[model samples]
Target chain A: MLKKRIIPCLDIKDNRTVKGINFENIVDAGDPIELAQRYVLEGADELVFLDITATQEKRKTLTELVRKIAAEINIPFTVGGGINSLEDAKAIIESGADKISVNSAAILNPELITEISKQYGNQCVVVAIDTKFVNGEWMVFRSGGKISTGLKAVDWAKKAADLGAGEILLTSMNNDGTRAGFACEITKQISEAVSIPVIASGGAGTREHFAEVFQETNATGALAASVFHFGQIPIPELKNYLKTQNIPIRI
Target chain B: MIAILKYNAGNVTSVENAVQNLGYSTIVTDDVKALRSADKVIFPGVGEASSAMKYLKEKGLDQVIRALTQPVLGICLGMQLMCDSSEEGETEGLGIFDAKVLKFPATALVPQMGWNNFTSLKGKLFDGINLENDCYFVHSYYAEICPDTVAVTDYILPFSAALQKNNFYATQFHPEKSAKIGLQILNNFLKL
Candidate 1:
C-alpha cells in the first residue's frame, strides 16, 4: 500500500534556510545541506526546499545549494520557489531534485505545467497551491501567499490536475504558522476532486493533528515547517502516533 | 568504458555525470557499434516504454543490445524494457528477464513517486548497502518479482527494485537521482 509521507519544508534564501513567522521576520536556520541531512536522519519521509528569495542572485545560489544538498541526501528532495520556466525546472531536476514545485510561475502561465509534464513526466511536476480564505471561500494566493489570484481552491486544483500536474501541494495560508490544524475541509474537497495525490501543508501542532488530517482529508501526505523544525513534534514520534491511529506510514 | 544507451529519454545526462564523477569514461550513444564495443552497457531511460522501445527498434539497437554478453545495467524504463513484455504501450520487451511490467491499478494513488526502500537484496550490485535505505523512484508501471528478483520495494504492492539474470542487471529506481547509496550501487555495478 502507498503510505502517507511526512515532509519537512525548508525555505531557502541566498543559500541559507530562512524560517519566518507568518511569512515575515525571517531568521536563518543554518546551512541548507546540514539542515536537510538532519531532517533525513530524523526520519523525514522527504524534504521540500522552497527558495523564497526570487532574485537572480538568489536563484543561482539556490541552484548550487540544491546541487550540493542533492549530492548528500539519499531520499527524494523537491525544489520550489521562483520556478518560472522549463529551463529553471530542468536545471533543478538535473541538479538531482526528484521533483519541481511551481506556484507563481504556474498560475502566471498555466501552460507551463503542461510543457513541464510533457518534458519531465507528470510525476516530476508538482503544482503548489497556496490558499487563503476570503469572503467564506478559499482563494488561491501567489508570491508566497501574499498576492491573491481570487481563484477558488478546488477549481484551481482541478485545473492544475487537468493541466497534468501529478500531485497537488495545497497549503492553507489561514492555517499556516497557526499550528491549529490542517484545513481539513479544503483538503478533503480538493482530494475528492482530483485523481492525483494531495499533500496537505500548513497548520500542524501535534501528532494527533497529523492523524486528523489523514483521517478527515484524503491527503496522501502532510507537510509542516516550524512544528518539525523547532522540535515541537519529532517525525519518528509522529509516525509512531499515526501508526497507532491505524494510518499507514513508511516506518 | 560505460555506454549509456540514449533513446531521447530524460536523466541520461545525470547518469553520464555520475559515471564521470566516479572517474569512469561513459559514452551516451544510440549507435550499435559504440554500444556493443563498450566494456559495460547501461540502458538509462526516463520516459514512456512504448516511445523509447520504438526508438530502440528504429535504430536496430535492440538486436545489438540483446546480443551483448558483457554486464548490462538498465535504469527505470530500461529495466521495464528488459522484461518479457510491458503494459505501457502493450509492447513486447527484450525478454532478457522473465518478468512482465504492469501498470499500477488505479487505486487511490497511481504513480508511486518519491523515495522507497529496498529489502531482500541479492547479487554484487548491492554490496555494502543496508536494508531499508531509501532510493528515489518515479514510475507508474513496475516489474513484477520473479526468479530474477534481486531487491524489492513496496508501494501499492511489493515489486522488484533490482533484478538480475546472467550478466543483465536492472533497477526500477533512478540510481542517478538517488544520491550516495545510489552512487554506491552504481559503483558496485561498474566494478562488476
Candidate 2:
C-alpha cells in the first residue's frame, strides 16, 4: 500500500529557513541546510522549500541554497516561489532539486505548467494552489495569497492536472496558521475529482488533525510548517501515532 | 569511474550527487566512449518514453547501451525504457527487459508519489535492504511482473520494484531520493 507522507515545509527567505504565521510575521528558524539535515534525521518522508525571498536577484540565491541542500540531503525536495518561467524551473532542477513547484505563476500563465511538464516529465511539475474561502466558495489566490483569481479551488486543481501537473499541492489559506486542521472538505473535493495525488497543506495543529485529513480526505500527504519546526510534533512519534490510528504511514 | 547517462531527462544531477556522496567519482555525460569505458553506468532519467527513446536513437546511445558489457542500472523512466514497450505515448522501448509497461488503473491513484515498501526481494540490490524498508516512487506507469523481476511492490497491483538480468539492473523507485535505504542500494550496486 502507498503510505501517507508527513512533509515538513520550510519557507525560505534569502537562503535561511523561516516560518510564518498566517503568511505574515515571519521568524527565523535556523539554517536551511541544517534544518533539512535534521528533518531527514527525524524521518521526514520528504521536504519542501518554498523560496519566499522577495528580490530582483532571488533566483541566484535560491539556486545556490538549493545546490547546497541538495548536496547534503538525500531525500527528495521541491523548490517553489518566484519560479515564473521554464528557465527558472530549470535552474532549480539542474541545481539538484527533484521537483519544481509553481503556484501564483501557474495562474498568471497556465502555459508555464505545461511547458515545464513537457520539458521535464509531468512527475517533476507540482502545481501548488493557495486557496481562501471567499463568498462561501473557495477561490484561488495568487501574489502570495494577497490577490484572488476567482477560480474555484476544485476547478483549478482539475485544470492543473489537465495542464500536465503531476501532483496538486492544495493549501487552504483560510486554515493556514490556524493550527485547527486541514481543509478536509475542499481537499476531499479536489483529491476526489483529480486522478493525481493531492498533498493537503495548512491548518495542521495536532496529530489528530493529520489523521482527520487523511481519514476524511483522499489526501495522500500532509504538510505543516511551524509544528514540525517548533518541535511541537516530532515526525517519528507522529508516524507512530498514525500507525496506531490505523493510517498507513512509513516509520 | 561511474557514469550517469544524460539524455533528455531529470535527476542526473541528483544521481551524480548521490554517487559522489558515497565517495565515488562520477561523470554526467552522453559521450559514447565515456559511458562505455566507465567502470559502471547508471541510466537515470525522468521524461516521456517516446521522446527519450528518440533522443537516445539520435545520439546513438541506444546501440551503445545495448552493447556495453559493464554493469548498468536504470531508474524510474530509465527502468520503463529498458522494457519491451510502454503504454505512455504508445512508445516502444529498448527491448532489454522482457516486461511491458502499463499505466495504473483508474481505480487507484495515477502516480504512486510517496514511500512504499517492497516484498519478495532478491538480487544484489537487496543485499542489505529489507522488505520493511520503503523506497521513494513517483510514476504512473509500471512494468509488469516478468522473469527479470528481482523485487515486487504492491501499489495499484503487484509490479516490478526492481529487476535484474545479467549485468543490467533497474528499479521503478528513485533510490537517489529514497534516503538511507536508497543509499544502501546504491552502495550495493557500486560494490557489485
The candidate that wins on TM-score is: 2
Which structure among the candidates has the greatest lDDT? 2
Stretch of 10 with least lDDT, candidate 1 chain A? A54-63
Q: What's the true lDDT of residue A38 in model 1?
A: 86
lDDT of each: 0.86, 0.91
For model 2, residues A1-251, the per-residue Cα lDDT tens digits are: 78999999999987888988889999998888888999999889989999887455878888888899889998999989989999999998989888999998899999999999988888889999999988899999998899989899999999999999989999999899999999999999999999988999999999999999999999999999999999999998999999999999988
DockQ scores of all models, one per candidate: 0.38, 0.82
Model 2 chain A TM-score equals 0.98
Residues forming the 10-long window of minimal summed lDDT in candidate 2 chain B: B6-15
Give per-candidate clash totals.
0, 0
List each model's interface RMSD: 3.3, 1.1
Write candidate 2's Cα lDDT for B19-135 as tens digits: 999999999899989998999999998878888888898889989988889999999999999999999889888899999999999778877899999878998888988899999
Error of 1 at A194 (Å): 1.2
